[model samples]
Target: MMETSKGNTSPLKVQLVYTTNIQDPNVYSEVQEQRESPAPPKTSAAAQLDELMAHLSEMQATVAVKADISKRHLPDKQDHEASLDSMLGGLEQELQDLGIATVPKGHCASCRKPIAGKMIHALGQSWHPEHFVCTHCKEEIGPSPFFERSGLAYCPKDYHQLFSPRCAYCAAPILDKVLTAMNQTWHPEHFFCSHCGEVFGEEGFHEKDKKPYCRKDFLAMFSPKCGGCNLPVLENYLSAMDNVWHPECFVCGDCFSSFSTGSFFELDGRPFCELHYHHRRGTLCYGCGQPITGRCISAMGHRFHPEHFVCAFCLTQLSKGIFREQNDKTYCQSCFNKLFSL
Candidate 1:
């Protein structure tokens, strides 16, 4: 067919536009015509509008598909991010909780320190961290709460104890226990063991075996011991003064400072030996500067030592050394020589 382009000497022809491959002879010929054609008629406004509408419709379909894809992917992405955030938040909270303190202050008795687990003391009583205790006997009085409520820290049973008292020794305030202890009270460890004839670390008051044994009794390997007197202890029954004593006993009355080698001297209604003993006296001697070992040396008249007279010329000591009395005034040798020369 002859194609016609604009008034530019082109054959007038209708070349069909195509997308798929043209296999038919007619379709191939149409492509060849389109190739030869130099120009085509200017599309009318209606025709242009129709073409623009077709493109707009295709674009709209493509935009709808993209929006659907975005909608499907956006929700999933947001949910995943939120789940991760929640897990991170939980882990952070777990870490913070793990660091919480297990013990609180004012829970420990002696040291007033924090206590995490259970701790039971010797007295068989439950106690808090800050509580009164006896330093001498290691007796725990009570929790700080009772003291906080009332001014006292111990019960009256603790006052008159003859031996070790922990709370009193530590100087903590006595509840009623210290007062009672001062009267007739004794700790559980105060009873004397009849076997060893020695006071045990603890006591059993009502225990009237009359033959009481202490921890030492259980620890003793062999040999039965006396329940009344210790080995070498003498027994006496003089009215209310029935007390047993050892022949070689040298224990101190003041600080338990024992005397050794075994000796005795009568002093203040008690036997005291020279060893493990000391005496106090006032007067001092000018010669030795110590309390006289009980006597003094003196210079009298012409029988005086040289130390008792000064040299006639030098006016110094006459030099018979110390503890001496010569003719008159005590004088050193140098002074005596000067006096003799004069």
Candidate 2:
């Protein structure tokens, strides 16, 4: 007879031993012994054995249930006889006949629950059909295209609104190729002149007032106008009279000649050479009928060259403020008193 010890136990204990018959090993007899303890047995040995057997049966049933569930979760083995389609068609029904339920193939990415029915595979994860929804709108994304950002799924409309670059002109999302200029974004077709609305070419564009423009419109609308030609002064321009003029356009308004001496006089908001400027304002000498560019004498209501101011009677040259006037003519003081001493 072989005896086995059950490690450690409480002070009060009942030891149960079962020995197999030598002739028939399957037949067994039970021997019960009560050890020295502070407490007596509460019930008979037969009743305690019955309770233990019932508990063992319950544990065994629980283990069987868990094993069945594990078996159903395992990956399916390759079927040599039937194709995949046939096996899938009858597999659920066959399991149901065996009183076993079908298990979920995957868990939903959104709700983190088993996907027993239709499943949506998106963004490298599986999801229940109803649970696969846009993060912003919370609307279902079943069978439709989606966008992914920051490990989250979104519908097409929300994705474009939230993430796509917007056109600076139209204020709409730039779904296609983007043209970035003027520190803003725009669609390729919408990146045009703000004034003319004509599209820009590879020559590039200009910016003004926080908007973009083609070369033609930019110069026409923003560049200063030439003072002479009254047209846009694109380059090589000069600023005069608070206006800009191209080098070729800066000419005399009257004679249409350029200032050879790099100097000009202004008349009525226009530039002119010294000769034409004096003539325009009637500042020329009455004797020579030429522009008096230097100091001149005013007598008889007409400007005169210094030597041209002479006496009407003796033809003597007169000094300024010492000359006398009579009958709209100029004369010296001595000649005036000699001719007509009144």
Candidate 3:
């Protein structure tokens, strides 16, 4: 019979039930003893499960710590890489400054061959100090004062000779200081006034006949003179009968009146008004026997008015179209044909 105690659980007894005995007896006994005893007060299944969960949590914590350490080292590794890159960049710039070209090494600009030793950096290329020579005069211009024009180097003296302005009067190069006027350049000592043989230095001048002249000489020598007043005709004047005269001095010879604006006749080298000239020197009209005041037609040593110089038979104007003259009498073609065609 099984015994039971009050409020106390009894140990379970496991019976060894065997079917076959092919194995060793000691092995079978050891297995039966392990099953029969109360497992020597072993921990419960739930406690063992809790212990396994704690071990799993500890392993997870260890893995998390390792991950955090790796994450902290990642930035340092990146910074180290960036520092290496910066160092490399600085080295490259230094190499460039030392004239070590980043591309394939090129030849010297002047010598047209591979550059070996010390080189100069100029004109967007490399060159040897001895090879980089001036284009003009063929002199070496290494680290010396020089000028560049049209992509070619030139020494100072040769550059000035090639580009400096030339004098207009002497036709010599203007080396130091220059005077510019009349759209030309001249040396300070070579610039002179045209009228007077005097040197002009920073003074006002005038140009005439493609020559420079001082103000006083230009006004006195080249200024026009009036024919009537015999004075300098500086500004507005009248030109008539091959003579220049002031506006106030232009007068009629016969009437002695000022002619503002009208037709004037020249007689005996004198200017006369229109009315007085017609009365004094105009020809007489043959038809009216009066002085011709306007245009007159002269034929056969006689002058006639334009309206009176017509066909006598037809009384038609003969100034235009064809006409015939008989016994000094003008006749139209129709009147002449009707009277004399037969």
Candidate 4:
């Protein structure tokens, strides 16, 4: 009546050998002869039980006949007759008890036949020693570990082959630990960076093309290069002028200094500080030789700040495009007409 758990794979050992009383007169002599001449090991316990049951059946009939004869012959011997009757009754009861106890415990779950000796107790059922077989191959799963799914037993090899999750990279069954990522299952060791072929650590990983990659390889292969430093931007980047730049890499083109005001001017698609941008564009004021950030006047083929553009004779501010150029010096209409009129 022993039951093994689903996880337990140890073989269930049941001793089916039954012993009879040696004090019985008829069986005592035969048992003595058996002890004197030992039987071979090849004689199975079931075979021995069958032989003993046959002998007991024969002895039961002989004792019945002997009791009948004693009842008729020893009617005058009361004391001896009572003792003999009690002994015969006790022996008969013992034999009946032995027959009941020797019956098989339960039917085999596989074959639906009574399991006699060495029954296997597994999956909350009894099975014959050879009947406890894998449901798939029908081969005996004797003593070895097995997997049970949906009330069916399977050997270790077949179970893993049929049901275990497969590794996405190696395409092999994952027997022990399974690592799941990117909608695929894998073995822990097989779940490595596709670029470097090394296992991922605490830094974790990145997914590209449905494969895992380390941070360094992923950035190098996929991340955009910085517009200033010309290196891959890992994170925290600025997007301007259709180019990406790492926060530290977004610097002025000439001075290589980061923008303090977070403002930049672009020339030929490159960012520069205000001073450098105006200098590069040749837009510096002619009078002050500095960049003109506000409105400026262009006269005498040179750009001049509005306040700096003056009439040469009157020293007053000349309007934009309303001055006369003479000797490479600018003058207003009235001043030019009055000073140089002939």
Q: Taking the tens digit of each residue's C-alpha lDDT, what string does model 2 give over 1-342?
A: 222122221221224333223221111222345466564565565455455446546755665565566556556554322333344445546434533345565787876765555556666667776887888999987756677787787888998999989988889998879988888898888877888889988888898878888899888888888887778877688888898888888899888899889999999998998888988888888777888877788866688777777787887877655887788777788888888787
Q: What does the lDDT read for residue 339 in candidate 4?
A: 81
Cα error, residue 260 of model 2, in Å, equals 1.3
Clashes of each: 60, 0, 0, 0
Residue 215 Cα positional deviation in candidate 4, in Å, after optimal superposition: 1.7
* TM-score pick, better of 2 and 3: 2
Q: Which candidate has the highest TM-score of all? A: 4
lDDT of 4 by residue, 37-80 (tens): 45445445546555665777887787877777767766477755
lDDT of 3 by residue, 1-342 (tens): 122222223422223222121221101101122344344554564455445446546755665565556566656877655554554455446545533333324588875755434455556566666877778788876656566677677777887789879998888677789888888998877777877878765667878889988877887788787878777788899898788898878888777898766767778877877666765664767766666877889876677888888888878888783678778777898898888786
Candidate 3 regions exceeding 4 Å error are 1-108, 112-120, 175-184, 187-192, 197-206, 251-342
Backbone clash tally (model 2) = 0
lDDT of 2 at 275: 81
In angstroms, give how far residue 292 of model 4 lies from its true place. 3.8
Q: What's each prediction's TM-score?
A: 0.16, 0.58, 0.38, 0.59
Arranged by TM-score with the best first, the candidates are 4, 2, 3, 1
Quote the lDDT for 207 in model 2: 82
lDDT by residue (tens digit), candidate 1, 47-160: 654454465467556655655565666568767555544544543354335331122212454544433333323232223423445333445543211111122233233332
Q: Roughly what TM-score does model 3 have, to 2 decimal places?
A: 0.38
